[model samples]
Target: MPSLELKAPSLELKVPPVAVMLLVALMMWLVSLITPVIALTFFVRLFIGAMFAVAGIAVALAGVISFMQAHTTVNPTTPNSASNLVDSGIYRFTRNPMYLGLLSMLLGWAVFLASPLALTGTVVFILYMNRFQIKPEEKALLNVFGEAFLQYQAKVRRWL
Candidate 1:
């Protein structure tokens, strides 16, 4: 007799995080087209959105820079390729600053669109990234870095 095995639905690291972010942005735009905008002045929305966008860019860039300095691969799809574990710079705050930064940019896009419905994309993006991208990356990292990775995970929040 053959043993029966159950299989889980997988989305693990198949899509690039940036591509996911862009797709979410497109969905947000589509939602904005049909939804009513929030009652805010254009300038106010632009200023706030721009602030979020700038902050997101800075945080994401910091993560990339830290990886570069450590001579590690910044490729999220290939976490196993990392040469060294990075615990400095923005990484000290959130373990996944790049994802957080992308989320921030999506939030900025939602604000700029002024559509309440568009904000839903942020939630979707977070859930998707958490399940599909980050989980797999963390698993790979745990394999590569072992105890050190566990210690880092204990110290840092996944997202902030």
Candidate 2:
């Protein structure tokens, strides 16, 4: 059987990860601006706000952990260039903790905004990551680590 070779076109002109993140956040804020006022009671809004705050903190912590583990280049689709394959800590749970973290943060923002449109933007972000980031990274990891990558994939989900 022929080995499946995964390939991605050169992304020479893509936006940086930080820039993409900021753009997503900005978009969420824009969504909040257009949201209609609701009749939610003050205490209920406060409770929801607190939930969002907690989610934001959790996402921020995950981002910090991901940054610490990021000893290699920022490109996820180039596992061959990685100094190490991080499979411990949060990595053991989900292959894309950083993306998950960002998603959680965006979800928190959506909640804080009390805007359904902002939540929809968060869903769009997830879809974008699955297509552009996670899929390419999975392919690159399989190419670089072969059986090891497959084993990890079996043990842990792409997201948790």
Candidate 3:
């Protein structure tokens, strides 16, 4: 009989999610300042930014509520401590609602800045999260929750 073997991810740089969000925000501000582009009317920019911010906040709050209900750890650095896998509420639509919320907020910031270059911040954020944060967390989750986690991951989209 052959045994199944899963290769472990090479985990590196475990920064807390809030810190990453702040760093990305700061970089977005720098990008806006350095490469200003696409001027829009005040009300238009405000409206779009506000819309994104509101939606992001709503989704993130829902995630928090679900995590609380499930008594799971929301700490991005410690997925192994999670008591339950929250799949209800906003989670049914997106696997990482909290991260999605942060990304959406970055979009809002970029729109508010009205800079095409600033918008790259959102893409950079997505890539960075996928590489440094999410991949490690996924590995940890698989270790802790095993088959159940894999099934949930198969059904849910990482970001939507």
State every prediction's TM-score relative to the real structure. Answer: 0.93, 0.73, 0.90
Which tens-of-lDDT digit does each residue in 1-32 have in candidate 1? 87564332356787899999999999999999
Q: Could you tell me the C-alpha RMSD of candidate 2 in Å?
A: 6.0
lDDT accuracy of residue 138 in candidate 3? 85
Better of 1 and 3 by TM-score: 1
Residue range 36-118, candidate 3, lDDT tens digits: 57879989998999899898888888888899999888888888888888878988899899999988888888888898988
In candidate 1, which residue ranges exceed 4 Å CA deviation?
1-10
**Most accurate candidate by TM-score:** 1
lDDT (Cα, tens digit) per residue for candidate 2, span 50-133: 776576567546644664676755564454575656677777787777677666666666666777777777777776677666
Against the reference, the lDDT scores of all candidates come to 0.93, 0.68, 0.85
Highest-lDDT candidate: 1
* TM-score, ranked from best to worst: 1, 3, 2
Compared with the true structure, the alpha-carbon lDDT of candidate 2 equals 0.68
Query: Model 2, which residues run further than 4 Å from truth?
Result: 1-13, 37-78
